[model samples]
Target: MTLIEEVKAIMQRSASDEYLNVMVPLLEDYVKAECNNTFRKNGKTVYPGGVKIFIAKACEHNLTVSGVSSKRLGTVSYSYDLDFPDSLRRLLNPYRRVRFHAF
Candidate 1:
């Protein structure tokens, strides 16, 4: 199966086609930036290794897109669900260019 198809599957019908397109790219771009575009190493791309991370981030991105689907958060606002899942946070935090600093 294609990479995008994999991402779409992990999304589990939460995101629409258009939103999925947007989010999947964000995951890719974020990875590229974090890895200094070196997703390829030893003649291989990390894309395979990072599939789960990509899907998690894409679902997180869908939350940001206001595409809450059948998640069943609540009425009027799903402000609570706006927080991205901790798994995505754990995956992306290390890859982030800027590290958090505690005061």
Candidate 2:
């Protein structure tokens, strides 16, 4: 599939070229980084599911729609988090791209 087709299918619509330009490279780099080596076979993906993996990951990273915030109580006890969801990890797990950490 072509870039436009992939973007539309993944993003659920046709995003701007500028938006795609940014995310496509980011997606490529992210997969390569996760592979910890190469993510290619004969100038293409080594894995058949590679494109879906990239799409899922890039979509996860692109969840930029802001949530509503309130300071109604007149206190300063506000918090924000941007942790990745478990579903996303599950989606990438089959590709062995799920990051693990020691803490």
Candidate 3:
């Protein structure tokens, strides 16, 4: 299945096609950025299998947490993470690239 289809399946029927159309590519880019693009072998770029699933999950996460940052009901409070989730970070760690800069 395509990435968007996977995302739609993950979401169990999303209400907005336009939102999916726009955000799926953006989330894919985010996943690529987190992985530092892709691994190049013999001048050919190769992507791992996990990336597509990661993008789909990330899209679901983004949809779930969009707009609201924090909330309070009485003394209890909740905070929504606006950044890339740590759980997702852990999943992508194997593909992550660390860059060394010379200053």
**Number of clashing residue pairs in every model?**
0, 0, 0
Task: State the lDDT of candidate 2 residue by residue for 26-53, as single tens digits.
Answer: 6666656665545567897544454565
Model 2, stretches more than 4 Å misplaced? 50-57, 60-83, 97-103
In order, the Cα lDDT scores of the candidates are 0.59, 0.57, 0.69
TM-scores, all models, native as reference: 0.50, 0.57, 0.64
TM-score of predicted structure 1: 0.50
Model 1, range 30-84, lDDT digits (tens) per residue? 6677544545668975564455555556565655645454444455543344555
Q: Please report how far candidate 2 places residue 35 from its true position, in Å.
A: 3.1
Candidate 1's displacement at residue 49, Å, is 3.9
Q: Report the lDDT tens digits of candidate 3 across residue range 1-103.
A: 6656666776644637788889877876776777775567889755565666566666667767453678899998878767766776677777888877999
Best by TM-score: 3
Clashing pairs in 3: none
Q: Rank by lDDT, descending? A: 3, 1, 2
